[model samples]
Target: MELKTLSEIDIISASTSKINQVDFENLTFGNVFTDHMLVCDFENGAWQKPVIKPYEPFMIDPSAKVFHYGQAIFEGMKAYKDTHDDVWLFRPDENFHRFNKSASRMAMPEVPEDVFMGGLHKLLEIEKNWVKKGKGNTLYIRPFMIATGHGVIAAPSSEYRFMIILSPARAYYSGEVKVIIAEHFSRAANGGIGAAKAAGNYSAQFYPTKLANEKGFQQIIWTDDATHTKLEEAGTMNVFFRINDTLFTAPTSERILDGVTRKSVIELAKRENINVEVRSVLVDELIAAAKDGSLKEIFGAGTAAVINPIVGFSYKDTYYELPKIENSMALEIKEKLTNIQYKLAEDTFGWTVKI
Candidate 1:
């Protein structure tokens, strides 16, 4: 039987609200979810109309392709509520484009724009109360797809399930982060799915990242897979190295994720007349700059943290401390981006989309 088409779609909403029971003050990032979700199924070479219903678990066979072949991808974005009682999303179009790119690379069908954006708007409109108006509070949106057909086959599944869930979130990281350079392990390779936000990309970093955590480092700056000598990304964020007055970051390749916040910061810096260099950032050059006191700042940028400063870094078991400068570029960029995100200032780049 064929699935229902998009034209006949009528979103099914949740019956009750969970806003009062939520502890807004004690949010632990993605741990707490909202009351509703959006789900759409892909089958028979067509995507069905999406449904917005109460958040609950769905069952899948143990031999699903997502389980056997890891055909899964997800995107993280946020919806903010300003003091003016309006809800807004930051660069959602970018997320939508990237999600399809990831799906293509993972051999999964793309989610239709209507199902992704329309369903998102409907769900957020109904759950608008969960978006608390404050400095750090916002709704963390997670959109993901998975292969759902039952089989132990190594090929891609014929059926897929796309879901979008919301979680009230605060700051992802509370303090300055300390990082360790990855000298032994690699995060992604030249022709890998690293740039695609595929689900397996993160799981590959767990063991090495755990070892870094044991050494008192909060994250790892992964290097190129070929030599493990050039810096690519810091943990889950794209990294930046500020030497003297120039900002440097590794160009995005198949091994690096094209981070939205990273691109925004580059644009923001260029507009401020800062020289931004996009190229390969070598580990040796970074250590040399650190030794000569030329490395002023090291930070990571992404959708979740926005901008995370690195207080120190470890290489070859030797720790180097970075000075706390008041005029750091990371802080400057973060303030500007946050202001635009929270509606505290004018959005010169037209980045925020009101809901």
Candidate 2:
């Protein structure tokens, strides 16, 4: 295997090529790709030379281990362009840490932080035009790894492929998502890969989430696997509940995802004097609170949609609705967070990293 340092990557001068023309304004999430991509391979106990190539597909063996044994993991993050056209990434180091965590869970070799960050910079610099300048427009960065060894045996593969793809995307509009409080299905279990963004974890959710969608709901608020009593998280985001004025969210465990946005919100909420509870929230207690008119709001914190407020939810055939308030904690924290993301406000927490 050949190893190349970050300094060795050549800055290639290429024109802004267009392909499969689509309307940028009306684009749905993760539907459009930029002109360039970054790729690297791992073999013989080392990561090989990295390359930046045009956005296209390549050949892979039909009997690849990743196809048969499902050895894959991925992460979701975004890149923002400010009014001055400066590119920035929100808490990229956090994403780097989490990506390694996911790799460890999937039995994949951990990627070097220098390689990951350096490759990202080179890719972003090449496709800088894909990052539109506006509040809602940004580049969605998908970094993923797969077992590429051509075999079907049930064992860890000897070869792997690491690639980074960029999509010119508009803000995801998950307007007032209606959710079902989980009672029958579980997203993750104790000592499972639920804490990490493993590829299998997402595939396991499609069947259950599709059922919820058929029942006129947008997503499912997953509960604990052992007992199914405590709220864990949502399909793709960490959940937060508000009773009266206090904010309650489940603490991260071996079964819960340690979301960067979730942790940032907790810190910001505590600094703002919002009573935050990092404990297991039970369905019965929340239902009782809603009955007594104390449940004020509920939302999900994630990188895609900074904060997605839940308008209502159903549990065991009972429905609960949240009243909209003038001063919503969800909106306030989202504004403060996005401001730092777009470099429009002071990053007192030192969360923004420029590329």
Which residue runs of candidate 2 sit more than 4 Å off their true CA positions?
1-5, 10-16
On a 0 to 1 TM-score scale, where does candidate 1 land against the true structure?
A: 0.96
lDDT of each: 0.89, 0.86
* Highest-lDDT candidate: 1
Number of the top candidate by TM-score? Answer: 1
Q: Write the per-residue lDDT of candidate 1 for residues 1-355, one digit (tens) a residue.
A: 1111234456666677778889999888888888889889999999987787889888888988998899999999999999898999988888989999999999999998878887788788888998999878889999999999889878989999999999999988877699999999999878889999999999999999999989888899999877888999975899999999999999998989999999999988998898999998899998999999999999999988879999999999999999779799999989888888999989889898888
What is the Cα-based lDDT of residue 60 in candidate 2? 95
TM-score of each model, paired residue for residue:
0.96, 0.96
Count of steric clashes across candidates, in order: 0, 0
Candidate 1 — worst ten consecutive residues by lDDT sum? 1-10
Each candidate: RMSD to true structure?
3.3, 2.8
lDDT of 2 by residue, 245-268 (tens): 999999999889999999999999
